[model samples]
Target: MRLTSAFSILCLSAALGTAFAASPVHTSGHAVTLDLISGQGTANGGLNFNGGFKGSKTFTVPLGSVVTVNFQNMGTLAHSFVIRKGGTVPTDADATDAAFPAAYAPMKVEAGLKTGMTQKVTFKANKAGAYYIVCGVPGHAMGGQYIHLVISKTARTASFN
Candidate 1:
């Protein structure tokens, strides 16, 4: 009985780990996982994130949460997904500055993944403020492919609204 119980516990733990690994947005004590899609629609001339454009959708998470974004490009054109420092529509310099090098997936700033490519990006929400998930391609963000990312000290969980 003891052996069986131990084996069962080990199996359960492994299963739970795998489940969290595959989840789109899974949050535990201090970690958050998200699946971010870029250019998912025709909105804003195909410049959009998660089907929302121009900060229409705001993703909120607790400050200090370890964030992992699994990014996928769904647009007809190549697109790069990146986290900029602010929520404003960026100038050419800001768009390709690669401010958060750890948060841009697939390549460096100004580099892009072709359509239908996927990559993972990880970072920490160390501060509470408004940020942006923008296209690293120059002029793309100004064309309206961006969304708001709010790292909130008061937010108890992760969500978008």
Candidate 2:
């Protein structure tokens, strides 16, 4: 009877540990993970290219938190990660603009490739609002290939909505 009770307690403890570690990311508390992909748009094909061909996604994080993004570059050509300031949108949907390198945050990975590559970066979610994540490739940011990361003041309460 004693041995059986001990075994049961051990099992329960292990299960609880796993559950605690598996908690979903929150907005203002712990660090969250963001996965992003980079590539070219229709403009790359040519000026005559009619169809848009770009990839992007937005992620939400908590205010004053940390985030880890496992980004992948799955496009033909070199690409880079650039965090731009708010309210600096381009007039052309596919136009490129110059960003402040000093203010821009870059996460280094292998040179962008068509086959795809992965890079992990961690940053503080100091700003409590919306921000843009884009590829520094000449015209990539102007394309639809950009992601919006919104940091809120609550824990695990962020959503694309």
Candidate 3:
């Protein structure tokens, strides 16, 4: 009876360990995991990343730090993750094409993932300001597929003279 009990406990421990390992890590060291998903709503068919829109719509990271985005497309259609140099998040429908380039003429980083696919995108947060993360696919960003990313300056200690 004692031997059987010990074996059962060992099996249970292994199962728990596997579950924890498969779970997504929010922030691994300096890298942040951003999970992107599409086809959230039936009416507008929105997009979501890292539990935003219904949760937190803002992502904060340290300036000049390396950020990793784990993008996943859970929708039936393909999607892309594109970071532009701007602070405003567009609200109009199918206005991504005209509004995106007009405001953020130059894009910082961009990545694309097909339907039911995942990708890892790593970029440095060199700038300290608010940036807009949107779907590069046409009509996607305007369909409410965008989030605000705030890059804060590193904390520093001041010395009095």
Winner on TM-score between 1 and 3 is 1
lDDT by candidate, in order shown:
0.76, 0.49, 0.53
| Candidate 1 ranges beyond 4 A from true positions | 1-24, 93-101
Per-candidate TM-scores read 0.77, 0.56, 0.58
Residue by residue across 1-161, what tens digits does model 2's lDDT show? 99999979976875575478632233333766554545534354421111122323445667756676555555556555555544655212211331223222233312332335666667676777756665555565565445565667764544432
Report the Cα lDDT for candidate 1: 0.76
Question: Model 3, 55-113: lDDT tens per residue?
Answer: 24666666655666666666656666666655456542222442223322113222345
Q: How close to the true structure is residue 107 of candidate 1, measured as C-alpha lDDT?
A: 57
The residue-level lDDT of candidate 3 at 151 comes to 70
Worst 10 residues of 2 by lDDT: 46-55
User: Candidate 2 versus the native: TM-score?
Assistant: 0.56
Model 2, stretches more than 4 Å misplaced?
1-29, 40-57, 90-114, 158-161
Angstrom error at residue 18, model 1: 16
Clashes in predicted model 2: 5
